[model samples]
Target: MKKLLAFLTLGLLLFLAACSSEGGSAKEPGNNGDTSDSAENAEKQEVTFWHSMGGAGQEALNKIVEEYNTSQDGIQVNAEYQGTYDESLTKFNAVAGSDSAPSVIQTFEIGTMSMINSGQITPIQEFVDADSYDMSGLEENITNYYSLDGKFYSMPFNSSTPVMYYNKDAFKAAGLDPETPPATYEEVEEASKKIVESNPEMKGFALQAYGWLWEQLLANQGALLLNNDNGRTDTPTEIGWTEEEGKSILEWVKRMVDDETFANYGTNGDNMMAGFLAGDVSMFLQSSASSRDVIDNAPFEVGIAYLPHPEDKERQGVVIGGASLWMIDGKSEEEQKAAWEFMKYLQTPEIQAEWHVGTGYFAINPGAYEEQVVKDAHAEKPQLQVTVDQLQDTKASYATQGALMDMLPEGRKIMETALEKIYNGGDVDEAYNTAVEQFNVAIEQANAARGE
Candidate 1:
């Protein structure tokens, strides 16, 4: 009987030890007594950002994120690189219906309309109002692109304008003055002719896919891509490219193709940039964002100038390009507040100037231009200063109204198809009109699909 009692006591003690081990195992890492209370107080709120900035640009963004993470303790930002601008939009659209959406996204200015209509974004106005952040210092015209129905949706981060990038060595070889890049459309044509005639081995000029080139040409001519404030207020109708200015742009493109002055450098800006960098193209029209890539990689001397307009002085303004950071919906007030803090932190003058100097993107904050640090940085590298000059007197273009068409990508596709047909010896006007008809159908169908 003594031995039985001893065995029973040992068994009870073993059972108690097992229970304690299991309880300890169930408790989560950093969890205290109250699970809900611990989650509320101890959990780190993470904001996920999806962006298209790669190469050196992405490294610069990573540095900014690291700085922010070290300076703060409550929130951690995870920046994920989502390849190229168009690919980033595609990935965002694919994941829009899932619960696994990013908390913050970097979207191109052109695609802002789609994001707004998707109802997945939390407007920046809420954060601004809550924090009483002063936005009066922002340039009105530049800020207007991201505003919809008089409410700001996204914060313009890396704004850029079209600029002329010329190869000075190519110009010299072509017997053209390397010191003076083309100042007008007529001069562009004339110089292009001289360049091609003198250097038969190289293409005189190169323009990126149909959409990028056509948008600038349309803007330079002061033509609207759509009626009624360029789709700023969500009108259903689209202004076809068969109009006077649109037709004129097509005609000019056709002339360039026929004269063999402009080479087809694939559908993206990087490809055209590669052609320029290789010394296979004399001149390239690209964004201010390309300033860093060209300066860092190109072996030849590069020249920068404003986008050329016709002889008319009134047509000097060009549209802004690049991307903006947007806040996502479906988060709690605390999370929203945290996200807003991160957003505002990114807009501070020192941060803006640092990012601009590091990545070749224009500083969206107006005071960044006047900051002595920014001025000193520009003084060291004069090419970086050209971006500020380009945006100094800039006006929003027709398409820059951030067109609200649901099928804009489709419209751009149709436009490209029409241009391809014209380039391959088809009728320009007929192809353009046919493209317009197809685009209208796509737009109407897209709208219907959305039940709008």
Candidate 2:
């Protein structure tokens, strides 16, 4: 049955992850918990950064590093692209044993808990205290996902939240107010009916068939994604997606799909982008980090708004969706200090503003919005302002602070499989129950491996 398939799929993923981490060439001294010679890092003028960003994200990152390098006379910061987030993290584990390990690497949002468990990274608080760095300007809501016990494990760089993007031209033709977008799932459903009535050839709403978006849907409705305060206060032994909150989301999706107001675009993000660009869908939801790409590619005027939620519950806000920079443990003092300096320089309002404008990522530093460049951009496209406003309005809660799970990657895949099954005519309750069961298996595997 489809339910059993989902369980087997995640079980396979767990097996592969274990084998890779513990067997064969993947086993090295400094990676995945073998920090043997990490202390032998020599004093060198060069510091390296391994990142997974590609395309526009990579270009923006390269530009910032170039400016940082030329701005100073001593340390030379070099960046290397290591493919997607998963591939990059695997590569980090592979090289963590050698001096070749990057001084600092960019690990994606979900990897935060796993990176902390790896024992290969040094806490940023160590360097921050040594240098007396001021971190007051960074947004607390954005930093919460990367922090633990009032301290940051890594330096948050590219951060983003989910937002609803609609075609303004389609709204006008559909007789809906372009200025006032849907604020709740009930409103979205109503608006979808009107839009589909006006334009029968186009779908009313389409979101990526990705687990992260579904997780955001629950979080926005004040639902926790994991146990123990999103795994902040304690390590979660089981997943938290089998509750009424998840069922509510599944029911909404089922309604939309049944009404032909929503349809599957597959799991790839490009499917969402392609469908929207070709006019197959009227509105969509994706990461704020994709703002630049969407704004550039859409042929119509794209309007952005905060993600809609259930009408009955208040919004708890969304979680940060991008990566952060982590200092590798065992480097020489000089390299460690230089890496810290580069991280601080990158956090400046001026640099943060530039990165935000160039890549459509959050400035991380709230002060960056005050910069002239950001102000001008906001004046040009008011949609840019929505992301910032949404962050400011987020309620500080366990749900909004975000979840930390060592099996997060596997959990996401489980959610993705459930969505695929539901869209393909499977029972929503059965699909979700399967996801919960599979995720618990992964949690147990992670706990046992970590000696919990």
Candidate 3:
């Protein structure tokens, strides 16, 4: 009942704007095969798509929109570049009270639960079911993350996984086989020790103090990042870092820091990458989405491999780390249908392949590998295939499905803070308990705010 009240309150903000005289009857300029804007008789549907991507990613998105616009004369989608993911979500929520929200928006995986709770989204399942769309070509593991209650809430896009990136030259110099990178945590430690022992000036590895990496480590071990099946069964009440998997990761990191085999490069992946490129470190773990820039900019030869798993466990899986397209609720049926059409157009093999080649993100559509562009790129850079195989082979599990808590973003903050505490001579048990207590407080507060 509380949640419903909050939903009503949210709807009230946009109610007046939605009922405004212009909003009730205003129509977009139709593309009706006529070059002139004077084709008043042609019916036009407009969709606003807000996103946080910029640079090469943004360029690819714009190209896709352009192609879609030219391919149809019924709907015209205006792609707006909002700031970061957080900023875009914030702007979206701020305007939730008004009828100014975009017809569709791109939100990062972290915001999935909050978006659902906001009660302002029309699940993609509704439209797909209405048309009986074929989704067999899409990667199941990638789609699993955006799904809830046994259905997809949004359309997956620009998906990625974390991979171990090593310097081939460093491996060879350390008398290790460049082709055989570390496959287990013990192997990583062995290689790092050798590299550092051989070259005292260079460090073995430097992991960014990042929540995503921490979460991936748990996923790699098939450990849930939170309880209640990552909060899918119920709202997550606390953090999961004090669990066995999380403890093992923290201990390993602490041991490495003490042994001088690893160092925390703060919370920035860019800094970690810079250290690797500058020969200060031999190995770094980063998102596969960064492959293009790392390969193009690094001075030394680069090698990619699935992230190291604990010796006890095989590489079970990794979580997706990108954004998905969500159709906002409260739009006209025509606008909603048009948004669905644009989404389907983007999923075509040719466009997905183009997106994969242009940006480093994987094509969510499995069939996209058959496209000439993807095949040609694979021929040129075989390392790209490593990432695709990783996602394709990852087995579906609660851990790999990724966390679904409404307090996920806040939970990550708590985990990162606790990580910093661990690195700074704080007691792991103490830090863990404190994080749980604090995180639950945050959850309760958030729940109260939402009337959940």
Candidate 4:
């Protein structure tokens, strides 16, 4: 009886030991275990970014996105190209408030008022305020365009301004100082005559009937496009510039037309660029974004100069042109946070320098100018520094801050039509008056549509 009892005790001990071993094995790395906590931590937050970058811009942006993705383990960003700004905005409107909406969307500067009115975006101000992010480090001119009522709605990314690109060889041939390109409407007119006289084969100047250029010209003269302080303080009811200020642009173009020195590209920037490259045109006004392309493609030396103003008026500056990143509403908190992180990453000096060199767009972060890559690029292509100088030289004013209105795209079309009329030798007064009338009607219609 004693031996049987001892055997039962040993058997019981063995069973308990077996149970303890099994439990320990379950907690080991290779065994089935409760890993819910680690798995949840391992899962990445996904952010969808819709952008309107194509070609070289798209390539540069993709590289940046890839770098951002691999640099971290907690979040992943997927950048989707959504065609041009107009097309992208349309797609966004279609999907807004739905699950398919992107975490972030890029809209052109002109789309600022429209985006603000859409109520579909979360103004970046929320993040900026919550994080106490210092925006003073960014380029003031760029921040100026994105800020409204002293608050940033979107984060400025790619920005550019209009500049006059002249052929140094052509200027020399015309007996004009190649280093000193024209800086005023009158001087441009005079240079155009000389350039035409130098070579009958090449036209002196080419102005594409682009509405953006028209806006730049007006701003250079410190003229506003809309009333009520460029629609910053209050809604604009009519054209802001006086009759003389408005007519000055028309008359200037008319003088070139009469002189037969104007190469009218008629709203086609590609053809204008082609004409300049092929030596069919000597000088033209275009975005600083084209600096690298023009300088690399031109057979002759290219000289970039600031946008010309009227001789009588001081140059205020060109408004920031390009797009800003808007954080879409209704996104998950994690997604929004990820998107904001990516934006801040983009504004870093190294990244901004890469972006500035890759694309001819200005670095929104002024610190990027100190990056070695940017310094090397500037040294190799001195023409690039001219763009930075021009932006720094710009005076702070409502005109330079640009006009904000939902009807700006429509107004651009109206102005383009007016410029075309003048380009085709139509009556300047007739075209100007018709454009002013149409512009006011468009503004009234926009205000009514908004129930303002």
Candidate 5:
């Protein structure tokens, strides 16, 4: 009996020892951060990129990723579509709370400040300056919006400028030359009046009427949307768009709305494009990035022109639209290095040119224009050159300057509310003042949250 008892105790001891050993070797819940692994130390780096572009944009992005994946053996890229831009941002924020987030995220231009404030992104300046990467060919202008205080946190990939898209059929029907798009806001108003009076069946001028769109218009007139260095001063600030210039722009819009020259289309994000496609609207003011959709699906000849200015010769350069590629912070050094390499590869002239032509965005690499394919495309379609031509005379606007605030998206919502009021018979000045006040409150909240 003594011997049996000793044997049982020995067996229990051994079992406990085995269990302890197993516990010690198991990895703790691999807490996912901005980086899956250390980019420097990773042996095999797999870059996961979350983007909102689907269809043609997605296909083009995938082609670039595939080429990068095959061009080298050290790293592999995985691309995933996260729906629309807003949805992608929401998904990113949600994933950031867990351990399975992607390494690269594509975020819209306005979202940059919010993302920067979130501290989840790794600056690209480090990667671009790395000995392994060559950034000489990248244009300074394209990189302007992605930079903050001389440090680049993101790389400009699919950059676009807003332009005037007029339906040639509508123009001709209205007895206006399709080639002579409105050159100024006054011209636009006059043209809109004529077009509306001529074509009672369709709306004359269609604005996307989003807050961002409003900001763009304000910027065109040299107005500042936010007070603190236009959000670049790096401090808490309030919305200043209720000022004289901003109010004037809104009043102009109100006039158009009142005259029935403009159509709201009820915030169907896709409806503005649909309006153009269905011939329900005469012309559209949208980003050049939309060229692909119009070309691929429009029922008639689409005319592209530079965004009209408040003055004919004084058209302030329009701000860039579209998103940039941002690397999530906290990745393994190896992964970051690989991401850098892939970014450099993606920015090559050949790739940029092909992407710009395929996706209807301007190439971040100026040298991209020298490529044979780009030359051929520009020759074949002259309107595709409008973005480039306008950019030559471009100067960033006070309001259009890249925003740096956590509450900008909210501010945009406030402006949208103001727009809604204007379109729905509210006093334009009163609505704008209310929006400005509301945005200021949001700004204060954001600043407080950031402990600024």
Candidate 6:
């Protein structure tokens, strides 16, 4: 009876030992038995990036995103095309503060004020502060636009300025120097007349009724689009440009209209671009970002020049026209960090070179100019260098830093209407007065809405 009892005890001990061993084996070090933990470590943090890049810009951006995905194992970035800037912003408004919102969004320069007010974005300044990231290497003009009061609210990405695109062949035919394109409004006017004289079939110039172009034209003449130092110091309440400064542009257009040298593609940039491509227009003002498309598609030799200023006023330069990447709020810290990493990757010299050459957008990182790809591209298309030079030569000023206001998009529409009226031979004084009154009302309404 004693032996049997001992045997039972031994069996019980053996069974307990076996159970312990099995349980220990399941969680042994380096063993993937705990799938939850393994997955947590192995899964990559996903970043959703919403952008408005289309055509060549979209292609280049997608390539960069793919490279970024493969380059790292910890994070994967998914870039979503969200259509035009205005359209994307509208969609963002719908999804903001919800899970449907993107991790990062690309907003245009003018949307800076709106984005800041939306309360849906975590300013990139937070990331910069946390990471001790140095932003000094970026182009000052670009950084200047995104920065307010010495703090960067967003990451400057695809930046561009307005430039005058002209046909070198047409300039030569007009008995003008192809190497020296128009430098002033008067010069442009003169060039336009010559171009018309040379080819009755071709219009001298076509200024698309684009509000952004109007703003740039004002900036080029050292005129602000809003008061209080372009709303950088304080909220604006009225028109910033003088009556004369604003009227000069109107008068210039009126002269072209009267002379039949202006091609009125009312608010249709696409049609204006088509006109240039079809050799129906000799010279036009457009974003430098279009440089690649214009140079590539045009059969005639293309020449890019600085945005023309009034002959009386010194050239103050152009405001950055493209968009910046904003980090959306409500995302996980890990996700925001991951998105920030992607943003940093984009600002690298190699990537900037690719973006600049691919889309003709200014490389926010000046170091990109040193890349061999940029060197080769500049060698092939010297006109690309003109865009760079123009940006670099821009004299820093409040006007050039651009205006900040939520109503800018609305204001642009107002200006567009005024420009169309002028293009159609409407009375300049009437158009200007109506535009000013409407613009002031917009500013006042925006301020009232903000309770400022």
lDDT of each: 0.76, 0.85, 0.84, 0.93, 0.77, 0.93
Candidate 3, poorest ten consecutive residues by summed lDDT: 32-41
Candidate 4, run of 10 with poorest lDDT: 31-40
Q: Extract clashing residue pairs from model 4.
A: none
lDDT of 6 at 411: 97
Better of 1 and 5 by TM-score: 5
C-alpha lDDT of residue 306 in model 6: 91
| C-alpha TM-score for every candidate | 0.85, 0.89, 0.88, 0.91, 0.85, 0.91
* Count of backbone collisions in candidate 5: 11
Give me the displacement of residue 323 in model 1, in angstroms.
1.9
Task: Write down the TM-score for model 5.
Answer: 0.85
TM-score of predicted structure 1: 0.85
lDDT of 5 by residue, 53-108 (tens): 88788888888887776676688888889998889998888877355778888898
Residue 41 alpha-carbon offset, candidate 6, angstroms = 12
Model 6: per-residue Cα lDDT over 35-147, one tens digit each: 65356446889999999999889999999999988887898898999999999999999999999999999999999999999999999999899999999989998898988
Sliding window of 10 residues with minimal summed lDDT for model 1: 397-406
lDDT of 2 at 54: 91
Return whichever of 3 and 4 wins on TM-score: 4
For model 3, how does the per-residue alpha-carbon lDDT over 1-452 read when each residue is reduced to its tens digit? 99999999989877877779656566657743454643521456888999988888999999998888777689888899999999999999999736899999999998998888889998899987899986656888888888788787899887899998899998899899999999888888889999998889888877777788889988999888877788777776655444677777777677677778885677777888988888999988899988887887889998889988889887888999999999999998988999999899888888999999998899988889999888999888888999998888888988888988667777778878877877776777777777668777887787788777
CA displacement after TM-score superposition, residue 68 of candidate 5 (Å): 1.9
Q: Give me the runs in candidate 6 sitting further than 4 Å from their true place.
A: 1-42
What does the lDDT read for residue 38 in candidate 3? 36
How big is the positional error of residue 374 in model 1, measured in Å on the Cα after superposition? 3.1
* Per-residue lDDT of candidate 4, residues 285-365 (tens digit): 999988989999999999999999899998888899999999999988888998999999999999999999998999999
User: What is the C-alpha lDDT profile of model 2 across 195-282, one tens digit per residue?
Assistant: 8999898888877778799889988988888888888899987765447788887777788888879858869788888888888788
Global local distance difference test of model 2: 0.85
